[model samples]
Target: MRSLTEEEIISHIPELSNVTLRKITKGYSFDLKYVTEWNGKNVLLRLYDLDLSERVQEKVEKMEAFKKLGVRCQDVYAFGEVPEENFCYTIFSFLEGEDGEAALANLTTEEQCAAGYEAGLDLNHMHELRIEASMKEHMAFIQEKFEKAVERYSRLDQQIPYGRKIIDYVRNNIRLIGESRLVFAHHDFHAGNLIISQKKYAGVIDFNRCGVNTAYSEFDKLELFSSRLSIAFSKGVIQGYFNNRVPELFWKIRSVHMAQLLIYHMNWVTDYFPKDLPQAKDAIQYVWEMYEGFHRTIPKWYEERQA
Candidate 1:
């Protein structure tokens, strides 16, 4: 679909007909974000082609759940399909602050860690908001997913670092993957989607990848992205989430999840973000470097600090 003009957007959503609208171009979520005023109040409008009613419903349901749980996120105002324009739009309050990536650049390492710690607590709360369907159901799901990932990754052509070691490690540690209690994972918890205000965490954004899974899976991505930001931040998140008593079991499973990502991440980047190939490569290298440490589960950065 061709990009809709501001007039077209206003026509579809009458509330925005009289307010100012400026396009938000920060992230790559195909949805169009317009920072605009409505009824003498500023809000962000996210408009995307309405493909499936179920998809839109799921997103709004999760957003609503997050808001109720006291997780710092946008308060969704309205969501419905624009029949004439074939678009679905959701209007929500705009979080007033710089994105965490830019904000972290100006913050001290300790401050960044504080931001990460706050974000981590929020994530733990999100996971606590909902429980998994059933132990049997999740067991079956995790088994099938693990078998498929290993079978496919073992056959794939790309040569990632420690390929055999990771595969063997995954196969040997198969039981650990599904042992952790399942909860709703924000799947993409990182600095990029966070909002920083007054050198502190304001809120989190973008729950598009949210799902029901093991909570530890969230750390896999954070460890990758936070490595580029600050090791202290990454360590702080772990400490804060587990209340400064990090569990050995969490680390064991986190290592497995990160290993699985090495095999599967390329396909993700190729399909959704081809432009991010270089960054993806760097992330993969970072994973390899982390695994190089003597303690297989604990990341190298955290291990270095403890030493």
Candidate 2:
């Protein structure tokens, strides 16, 4: 909620002059400031949460590549940690327009579908990047992340009928999804992270969950969102992404995404779970239902995709 003072802005980026700084985001890990000048040029200053040095560097690189691929994203101007100041900071050109979440309320379902499609194409383009030798190395990190989630899930106190089913789906299908020879993925592709200007797609934000991985991972995330909204809408986004029928590996990818989400939500719901225990109980139940619901559909979904 605090805006950066003019003196603070001048001190942080000494070359930057006569620009006004406004606070934009106060999300979990980063504080975002949009620095604008009288001429309307602007840049974003991101002050990271305490102790996330590695992630900040990695995220910047991902955004850089995405920009080259014609994905609308901010270009990084600078990043570093000030030992004296005790904060790791990054600056990027402020992108135009509001976030997708802000714009979605005004868009028709059809417009949303088109935006989703554009995102899918961008996502697919990123996935098409060839990194043959490094595939295994990159997937190892993804596997490790998922493994930790699985381990965490195993430690949860809640007993849900769908947990074992979700586990089984993951164990059975990981190999198929892993066989992909694609490049990186934006593992957290969702509407909230996308930026829209006018009626067209502009760019995406938040590459924190990004890494070298399969294209299917991106599809999986989109499909899950679609399903949450509406199966028809999900299908529309899928068509935009693939431009054809869903791939054989899609179900496997879906299972993996599901498993990952289940574990993630469980960990999330636990760590910062609200004081309202019943709400937490309902959340747990909802995730369990998602696990059960998706598990039952895998067989038919895979069959349809195969056909």
Candidate 3:
């Protein structure tokens, strides 16, 4: 797709008539994103193909809902289709800060934990917007998803080591999915989507993957991303979300969630991002070691930190 010039953008969205566009090239999202200034403040403009109109609307609604609940996130300034360009767009108040994954290394362990705690608290707040699905319905959906993931993994030419063990673990603990509350989830919550300003979490970004699911399913990314960046921060997120009282059931559910990801996400990377397959494998290995091949529930990083 051709890039949209500033002139073309201003012609369609008159409110941004004087804004200069600078494309953001950091993430894996297929959306065309640009950073610009509007009304004397920095803003982000995300352009999605017209076919994804529904997703854009849903993203805007979710962002508005998160804002109303006091979650630190982008505020939608404007959103609509740019029909002439065959794409739709949303302009948001830009978050000013460094990426949390990159910034956490500069912070003290305590400081990292504090930022994670705040992020966890914000995530907990977002979950307040519960979806009306019953536990039975949620369980059925999870079981179907698990079965599909297992099928896909089975068909893959390249499979991770100990794939059978992971599948067995998920099957054994699948019942725990029924115990979870259905809530709005960020879906991709992790240090990579977080923003850090002056060693504190500024806000979260990239709500494109938001949806409804079992609440504890949200933490799978903590194993894949956050803990690799800062164990203290990952631990803090859990502490903040659960009010410093982590539950045994949480560990059980989290392990099951991680097991599913081992199959599902790896298949995803294989199909859509083959180059990332090695990194994905390493991440899977790390998870296996962290949980000791599902022999344990709580990861050693969280447990040793408490000790």
> Top model by TM-score, which number?
3
Off by over 4 Å in 1: 146-158, 293-295, 305-307
Candidate 3 pairs with clashing backbones: none
The numbered model that scores best in lDDT is: 3
- What is the TM-score (0 to 1) of candidate 1? 0.90
Predictions ranked by TM-score, top down?
3, 1, 2
lDDT of 1 by residue, 27-137 (tens): 767778889987677898887777855676677788789888878888888887887777888888889998877888888877888988888788777876755377678
Model 2: lowest-lDDT 10 consecutive positions: 298-307
lDDT of 2 by residue, 161-262 (tens): 566766676666666666666667777777666777886677777676777666666755444343444333345456666786677666556666666565
User: Looking at model 3, which ten-residue stretch has the lowest summed lDDT?
Assistant: 298-307
Task: State residue 106's C-alpha deviation in candidate 2, in Å.
Answer: 2.0
- Per-model TM against the reference: 0.90, 0.77, 0.95
lDDT of 3 at 36: 88
